[model samples]
Target: MKITCVGGGPAGLYFALLAKQRDPRRDIVVVERNRPDDTFGFGVVFSDATLDNLADADRPSYGAIRASLAHWDELHTHFGGRVLVSRGHGFSGLSRQRLLAILQDRARELGVVLRFEEEVSDPGEALATSDLVVAADGVNSRIRERLADRFEPRIDVRPNRFVWLGTTFPFDAFTFYFEESRHGLFRVHAYRYQPDRSTFIVECREDTFRRAGLDRAGEDETVAYFEELFADKLRGHRLLKNRSVWRSFPTVHNERWSAGNVVLLGDAAHTAHFSIGSGTKLALEDAIALVDCLGAHAGVPEALAAYEAERKPKVLALQRAAQVSLLWFENTERYMALHPLEFTFSLLTRSLRVTHEGLKARDPAFVREIDAHVASKAEAQSGVRVVSADAAPPPPMFTPFRLRSLVLENRVVVSPMCQYSAEDGRIDDWHLVHLGSRALGGAGLVITEMTDVSAAGRITPGCAGLYRQDHAAAWRRVVDFVHARSRARIGVQLAHAGRKGATKRMWEGMDRPLERGAWPLLSASAIPYLPESQVPRAMDRADMDQVTSDFVQAARRADEAGFDLIELHCAHGYLLSSFISPLTNRRTDEHGGPIENRMRYPLEVFDAVRAVWPADKPMSVRISATDWAPGGLTTDDLVALCGMLREHGADIIHVSAGQTDPSSKPEHGRLFQTPLSELVRLEAKVPTIAVGNIQSYADVNSIIAAGRADLCALARAHLYDPYWTRHAAAEQGFAMEWPDPYRSVERYTLRMR
Candidate 1:
């Protein structure tokens, strides 16, 4: 079999060497448009784990690379007139030219042909001639462009402008330098890759670049400008250039990594943002995975499929994390107002890959200092004196949070989870056990699932409701039990299913219309929730009035049932949410079209409910911060909506995302919705409850301590462990009150701890 690799970068060269080593008789050739000695960029960094993989794959090249490496274990951040050094983050860096040289030599030694100064404009010709064609070209790959439709590449050019250059600074640790200029905030990422040379990449927003005249400045002039801007940290070092020019980082992604006999590798297939420093590492890892897959499979198609199946998910995860880090740098100004300690911490954990516990493991003393600082501030704000300053206070999750007149014992909330066990809008034993158990589990607040406002508003026949007197009486029984048995405050989420109504039970087939007894639906527009679902009648003035009246009546019942809080469920493609999302609400009347018009009806409903509900009790609104689809609500739109809600007497905003359309693409992961919560909380200056995949106490602590959200809601985790909060308190060694009946058990657990 003959294999030809395009563009002789590390990914292509390494693959040539490994494939030859795996099969000595295999014919392999690496083609490059540039000379063997010529390369762009200065140095590439890798983690200790990556070094281990390299050593296992090919020891001689790994040894050569390791000998050339400049390693460090400290990350220094120079910010706010102070330098914060965090340790135990091991990284190794080597000059890109040297690394490529080593791979080129190894490939030649393994009987692989290297062709320099040869460009392949048509990858299809190479694919036809050879058994396999590997496109390992850089971010702007000609072969990828030639076969763009087959691969379906998606390239996102980031907002900030960055220039990659080198300096003779001799930096011992990976360093981040941030400076505030009249133009905007400028940041530098520098790390030593040789005894005397370091990679220095300066970055700033586009507005800042234009303000500083960097867009028009020559390469030397740009370097000079950055040198002056970062002079304090750079000292007297000279900045060197190698075709370094101001440009936005293009994050490349391919829907299909392979088409026919051709496959993409490294930057050609995907590019993670450089903020995480994983571009080279991922490229090499892809090379390794491709070689292994080829060796394992007999057919080229099988090998390509297996390679993509194994590597795509991992690359996507890293890309997602890189995106988070990129966004953090783009919006650094938002966190500039934070205290220096928190600012430094936020910088260190920007990617969300690292956690408070993980940081503590790496550098216990540093984490302890941060904990002490946070505890001091928390104490000052709460006026709750710690019994012992010598002992570290409980984790921030244990800290009490105040919402208007209500003071929660902790920041943990049991997010509303639908049970679909109610009968004709009346709560049954299943509802009682579900809500009552979480309350007993020691959550600060327990919110009921989307309880319909009227019979026609339910998503299914089993959905709980607050419309009928029987429904109110049934809910009162459960609420009374929780009030008597636990200190947890309960809230009711009053919702109208709108176009999503007349669905079968979730266990049977969620959102599917019932074979019989399916009622007609209504929404802001005459649209169906899905292609097969019922087409909802466009709500007229009478329909809006009745819905608003139903919500007011539900609020009255919720109050009478002794619910401590009321959350208007206007999210997740519900009735009010239908009006907010452009994809669902296509009406051009006074109730839709522009965002202001789209928000009109929801605001009216909120106003009516606020007028009827008790003034002292807080009312929260659950909103889908983004539809996660094109031509839908965005974070900016949600922020504006939140501002309007605040003006209309909303006490809190519950932040959730997506489910507005079937085609919506949600970036799912742990704490995925927290960023939306952070934006709304800061931009709108409204307290927020963050819900979605919040799994642990550490997450709760991080979200609260970082000011990302005032409270975190856990759903599935609570279903698996009803005593999640109690166990969290135990794990953190904090004393919490238990019910009288469980006092003995609590005592035993405390003693065991």
Candidate 2:
């Protein structure tokens, strides 16, 4: 087989070498636009894990690269008049020039043709001649662009501006510096790649760049400014430049990796942000995977298909992480207000790939110190010290949290989960066991499932309610038991189903209409919840007044039941949520059009409920921060909504996302919705409870310590294990008490795994 690789970068050169080595009879030629020694970046960094793949793919190049690599295990963070060191993270770096030289030599030795300083203005010529053509060109690939009609590329140019340069300062560890300037905040990503040199990168917001006068400055002025800004860490070392210009990082993504006999590799296919240091590593790995797939498959189409099918998922995952890290750096100014240690921790875990436990595994001592810092601040604020000076501080999840008169024992909350076993909107034994066990299991607060304000408002026949005076008695029994038997505070989430009403139970079929006895639903507009479902009547003044009355009555009943707090369920495509989301709400009256008008009805209900509820008791409003559809509510909308809720006497905001429309497309991952909560808490200046996909005590601790949310609500974790808090406490060796009756079994249960 004859192969032509375009752009003699890592991907092209490495693929040429590997394919030739795998089959000595095969012929390979690499085309390049620059000399072997000419490279744009100063250095390339990789995790120690990448070396194993390199060794397995080709030992000679691996040995050559490893011989010149600079390895480090510690990360030094310089910020806020202090330097924090975290150990046990292994990384290796090498000069980009040296890496290219090694790959070029290896390919030549394997009988692969190397043609440098030759630009291929047209990649089609090679595709017409070679059996398979590899588009290994870098991020600005002409080949990918020429075939853009088939490739379907999407490029996202980020906001922050950054420039790459080199320095003679021999840094011994991976280091980052955050410095405050008169203009704004600036950051440095620097690390040693050789004995006498390091890669230095400067990044700041676009506004900050303009403020610092670097946007219009020449290369020399730009380098001089960064040298002076970070002079303290540089220790008088000078900055180096080679075509260094400030620009935004464009994240490139292609819908298809292959077109006909031509295929894209490395940056030609996708580009992860440089903040995660995966550009070189992913480029190299792509070469290895592409070569293996070609060797395993006979047909070019089959090989390219197998390669993309295997590699896209991994690349997309890393890109997602890289995007998170990029956003963190872009928003560095917002987090600089935190305590120094907390700020450092937030930076380390910004990608969401790292967790509290993951950091603990890397450096237990550093994590412990962070915990101590968080515990000290938590203790100072709550005025309840649980640990002595010599004792290990309690995990952030076990720290106390307060909202108005409700003082929670810890920050863990049992999220309201629907249990379709209620009869006529009244609680039964199933509700008791479902909630009581979690309360006994040692949560700080256990929130009851979506309790409807009226019988017609219930989602299913089995949904719990706070509508009737007798219904309050049923819930009162459960609330009384939780208060008497454990330290857990119980709250109720009162909701009205709106257009989504009269649905079958979730187990039967979510959002399916009931076979019989379906009730008429009311909504902000006369829209159906689903294409085949019931069309709800658009709510008029009378319907709005009745709903407001229903909510007020529910709050009164909740007070009578002696609940610790109340959460107004204004999220998840319910009545109030429908009014807030543009996708669902369409009216010509005062409660429509702009976001302010859209939020009017929800605010009116909140005001009425606040008047009827006690002054000392806290009420929270759950809101869908984003509709996950075009022209819908977003985190920006939440800022104004949260401010309005706060003005109406809401003590906290429960942040959730999506579910406002059935066609909504949500990006799901670990703690996916927590960013929404973080935005609400920071931008909106309100306390928020983060819900959705939060699992494990470490997640809770990280969320609280990072100030992303005031409290964390875990739904599936609580359902999977009623004693999740106790188990977390036991795992951390914290002495969390169990009820006296269950104390005997606690010892054995805690040890059960």
Candidate 3:
């Protein structure tokens, strides 16, 4: 079989070499628009794990690349007049020109033809001759453009301006230098790739670049300005340029990686942001996957399909992380107010792939320092005296947090999870054990499940409620038990199920209507939660008034029952949430249409509740940051909604997503919802409690220390272990008080250990 690869970049060259190595009998030729010696970028970086993968694929080229690699284990963050160094993050870098030379030599040695200075405007000639045609061109692929209809490509041009340059700094570590100028913040991603040369990349927001006159400046002037700005760290090193010009990164994505006999590879197929330093790595990895797939599959079409199926998901994951890192740099101004230590931590975890435990595994001492600082700040704010100067400060999870007049002993919150064990909307002993144990277990706060505002509003017959006096009296017993036995604050989440109401218990069948005893539902529009479920009545003025009164009365009862905080349940297709999400709310009245109109009823209900709830106690609103479906709620909508909620006296926003519609495609992963909370906190300038997929003490510490969220609520973790926070404290070796009756158990357990 004959294979022709277009372009002589890393993707084309590496694929040509690997395919030849896989089958020495196969004929292969690589076409290049530039000479083999011509290259643009200075250096490319790779992790040690990537090096291992390369060595397994081919040893000779791997040995050659490894011999010339500049390796480092330390990451130096220079911010706020201080340099913080973290070690054990292994990385290697090599000159891009040298890498291409090695690949070119290896391909030639493997009997693959390399055509230099020959541009292929059309692949028709090669397609007619070769059995397989690979479009391994770089970002600007002529072949990909020619077949635009076949491979639908979407290119998103990012906002920040960056230039790739080299310097003779002789740096030994992966270094990041941040400097605040009058124009804005300028950042440098510098790392040594050779004995005397290092890759220096300068990035800034578009406005900052324009303000500094870089948009109109020539290469020499651009280099001079950056040199002068970061002169202190450059140490008189000279900056060199090889066609380095300011350009915004274009993130490329292709709908189909292959069309007919031609297959797209590397940047022509997809491009992750450079902030994550994954372009070259992804290209090489793609080469390996494609070659392996081709060797395993007998047909070219099957090989191409399998290659994309295996590689697209991995590339997209990294691209998502890279996008997060890109946004962090774009909004550097927002994090400038953080302390230097926290700023360093935030930078390390910007991609969200690096968690507190990930850093702890790399550098335990650095994580300890972060934990100490967080503990000290929390204590200082609460006016608590340290027991001893040398005593280890508590972990971030054990630190005190305040909201209005309530001071939580820690940052861990037991998220509201429905038990569906109530009787006639009245709390029972089950409530006392469920919520009371969690409060005793060491959480700073525990929120009850969706306590409905009215009997007709309940999701099921067993759902808890706050509408009746007996309900308030029953909740008081549980609240009193929590208050008497622990310092944890208790709160109630008042919700009305709306179109999703009258469903069976979760164990019985979630979202399924009860065989009997089902009640009529109400919503912002006459839409059914499911096709088989009842279609709810479109709420009129009277329905809105009655619901508003129900919420207000529930708030009064929640306060009477001694809840320290009140959270309005405006999420998960509930009554208030139905009025906010466009998917569920399609009313033509004043309470629907645009998002502003949809938010009207929810805000009115919030106002009514706030008017009755005690002023000293804080109130929060739980919102679905996104509906995770097309034409549904988006982050932009969430930001606007959060701002409005803040204006209407919400102390915090509980950031959640999905469950607004059944067809929503939510991306579930570890700490999936935290990014939504972080965006809300930064964009809306509102405090947020991140919920969903959060587990472990390290998660709480990382979220709070990085200021991603003011608090973290865990549902599954708390359900798995009511003493989750207590276990975390013990794991961190912090001394926390135990219940008087359980003191003996703690002592016995410690002695056994």
Runs of candidate 1 exceeding 4 Å displacement: 121-125, 380-388, 732-735, 743-753
Judged by whole-model lDDT over C-alpha atoms, candidate 2 comes out at 0.90
For residues 434-467, could you state the per-residue lDDT of candidate 3 as single tens digits? 9999999999999999999999999999999999
Candidate 2, residues 1-753, lDDT tens digits: the string is 999999899989999999999999988999998988888879999898899899999999999999999999999998888899999999998999999999999999999999989989767788899998999998898889999999999999999999999999999999998888899888899999999999999899999999888878999999888888778778999999978999899999999999999899999998888778999899999999999999899999999999999999999999888888888888888787788898888888888788888889999999999888878877776677755787888888998877877889899999999997888898998898899999999999999999999998999998889899999999999999999999999999989999999999999999999989999999999999898899999999999999899999999999999998999999989999999998999898899988899999999999998898888889998989998888888656779999889877899999988898999999887888888888888887889999988877888888887788989999999989998999899888888887888778656743345
Runs off by more than 4 Å, candidate 2: 749-753
lDDT of 3: 0.90
Q: Which residue pairs in model 3 clash with each other?
A: none
Best by TM-score: 2
TM-score of 1: 0.95
Question: Which candidate do you rate higher for TM-score, 1 or 3?
Answer: 1
Work out the TM-score per prediction. 0.95, 0.96, 0.91
- Each prediction's RMSD over C-alphas, in Å, is 2.4, 1.9, 3.3
lDDT of 2 at 749: 42
Model 2 TM-score, all chains together = 0.96
